[model samples]
Target: MFRVEEPINKAADRMLKTVQLGIFNSIIVNRLWTPLQQIKFFIPTGHGTLLGTWRRLAVCWFAVCGFIHGIIEGWFSLYYDIIPGDQSFLSQLWKEYSKGDSRYVIADNFTVCMETVTAWLWGPFSFWAVFAFLTNKPYRFVLQLIISLGQLYGAVLYFFTEHRDGYAHSEFGHPVYFWFYFVFMNVLWIVIPLVLILMLGDSY
Candidate 1:
C-alpha cells in the first residue's frame, strides 16, 4: 500500500509542475514578453545610450506601474463604462477609493472634468509607455517626465482643494494608508521623473 501511494504522489507532482510551466510560458511568451528578452532589456549597452542600466530600470518601473494603474483607472473606470455602458467592480472600487478623495465628493465642476479627462488619458498612455520602454524605443523618459509632472500637479491641486473644502485632510485614508500609499506614492512620482529627466538631458 505504501509503495503504491508513493508512485501516485510522484505522478501528481510531475503533473502539477507541467501545468505550472505551461501557464508560465503561455503568459510570458504569448502575451507579456519572453523571459530572455525581458532580462536582456535590463542590461546596459553603454553609459551614454538611453537604454543604459539605470535609465531602463527607471523607465521600466514607470511603465509597469503605469500599466497596472492604467488598467484600473483608465480602462475599467472610464473606457469600459463609456463604450459598452458597463459599470464594473473596478469602477465601483475607484468610487470607493474616491469617497476618501475630495474630487469625487466635493461637487465641483472643475474637479469633475479634470478627473474624468485624466482617467481616460492615462490608460492608453500607460500601456504605450511600457511597450515603448521595453522595446528600447526613444522618448520613453520624456513621456514619463510629462506624466509625472501631471501626477504631481493633480496631487497638489487635489490636496489644496480638499483643504479649502474645510476637510483638513492630509491622508488618503487611515494614517498608514495615507502616508505610504497616498502621500509617498505621489511624492515619488514627482521625484523620480525629475531625476530621470535630468539624467536623460545629461546623456544627450
Candidate 2:
C-alpha cells in the first residue's frame, strides 16, 4: 500500500511542476510578443530606415562641427588680443564688424554674438539625437534629451552670462540663423556617411 501511494504522489508532483513552468513561460512569451514590443522593433529596424539614415547623418555633422570649434578655441587662446592678420572669410568679417573703440560696442557685441551663435550650434545635442535614432541605443536617447536641454541652457547662459549688463542691444539678431546653422552643421554633415554605412550593412 505504501509503495503504490508513493508512485501516485510522485506523478502528481511532476504534473504540478510542469504546469508551473508552463505558466511562467507563457507569461514570458506574452511579454515578448506584445504589440508594444513589436512596434518598437518595427520602427527602428524595419520600416523607418530613411529616418534612421537622417539621424546618423546628424551625428556625423555635429562631430565635425565640434572638431572645428575645438580648433577655433585653441587658436583664440594662443592669439589672445592679437587678432589674426589673415584675410580669410571669418577674419574679414570680424574686421568689418569689430570697430577698435569701446564706444562702438564691437567687443561686447562680438562676445554676445558668438556666445549666442555657439549656443545655437549646440553640436553635442544634434549628434546625440541622430545617434539615438540611428543606433537605437537607449543611452543615445538619454544623451539626446540632455542635448536638447543643454541647448536651452546654453541660450539662457548666452543671455544671462554674456549679455548681463545690457551692453548689447536686446533686439532681433541671428538667433534663428544660429539655430539653423547649428542643426545643419552638426547633424546633416556628420551623420550621413555613417548612416550610409549602416545601410550597406557594414560595421561603423
Candidate 3:
C-alpha cells in the first residue's frame, strides 16, 4: 500500500511553493513592467500614458547609472582612492590589515561599503515598484513583497556580513565634509538613477 504524506512535510512543501510562486511572479511582472503604476511606485500621479514611451528610457538611464557606479567605485576605485590622503584607501586598508590595527568594521573590505550603499539605495526603486503593484492589485502583493524583501536582503547583507565589517570606521584625520562627501557621493550616485525612474512615471 502507498504511504500517506506527513502533515509537516506537506505544509513545508506548500510554503516553499508559495514562496517560489511569489518570487517567480515578481520577476515576470518586473521584467515586463506592464502595469506601470502598479508595479513601479515612482510613477508620479496622472502619467500612465507616458510610462510606455519613457519606460525603456528610464530603464536605460538607471542601467547607465549602475554602470557608472561600477566603473567609478568598482573599477577605478575612486571612492577608495583620491581621498585627501597620500595613500589610496585600499593601500591604507592593506596597511591596517597587515599591522593588525584596524579601526573600522568595514576597513578591510572597501568594496563592501560600495555594495552596501548601492543595495540600500536600490531598495527604494524596488519598493516603489512593489507598492505600485499592491495598490492596484492587492491580490498580487505577495509577489511584490517578495521582491522588496530580496532587495532588502541584498542591502543588509552588504552592511552586516562579517566579511564586510573589515573597515567599518575610518582612521584618517579629516574634516566632517570628508566623510560627508564620501557618503553624499555614493548616495547621489544611486539617487540619480532612482530619480530618472521616477521622472519616467514610476510611482512610490
Please report, in order, the local distance difference test score of every candidate based on alpha carbons.
0.52, 0.41, 0.39
Task: Say which candidate scores most in TM-score.
Answer: 1
What digit string (tens of lDDT, one per residue) describes model 2 on residues 1-204? 123455877767644644654465456445533532333334553344433444444354444434433344233323324444655543432332232212113334445445435434544445454455555665654554454445445434444543454533332233322222223323433344334434443322
lDDT by residue (61-112, candidate 1, tens digit) is 5554455455544543344323323356545444433434434433356555
Q: Which 10-residue span in candidate 2 carries the lowest summed lDDT?
A: 96-105
Candidate 1's TM-score:
0.56
**How big is the positional error of residue 2 in model 3, measured in Å on the Cα after superposition?**
78
lDDT of 1 at 100: 40
Give per-residue CA lDDT, model 3, range 107-201, as digits (tens). 34544454445444443444444344333444323333443344345434433542354433432222221233233323443454445434433
Off by over 4 Å in 3: 1-48, 52-61, 76-107, 110-168, 171-179, 188-204
The per-residue C-alpha lDDT of model 3 at residue 180 equals: 31
Clashing pairs for predicted structure model 2, backbone only: 56-191, 57-191, 57-192, 58-187, 60-190, 60-191, 61-186, 61-190, 61-191, 62-186
Could you estimate the TM-score for every candidate? 0.56, 0.36, 0.29
Q: Pick the candidate with the highest lDDT.
A: 1
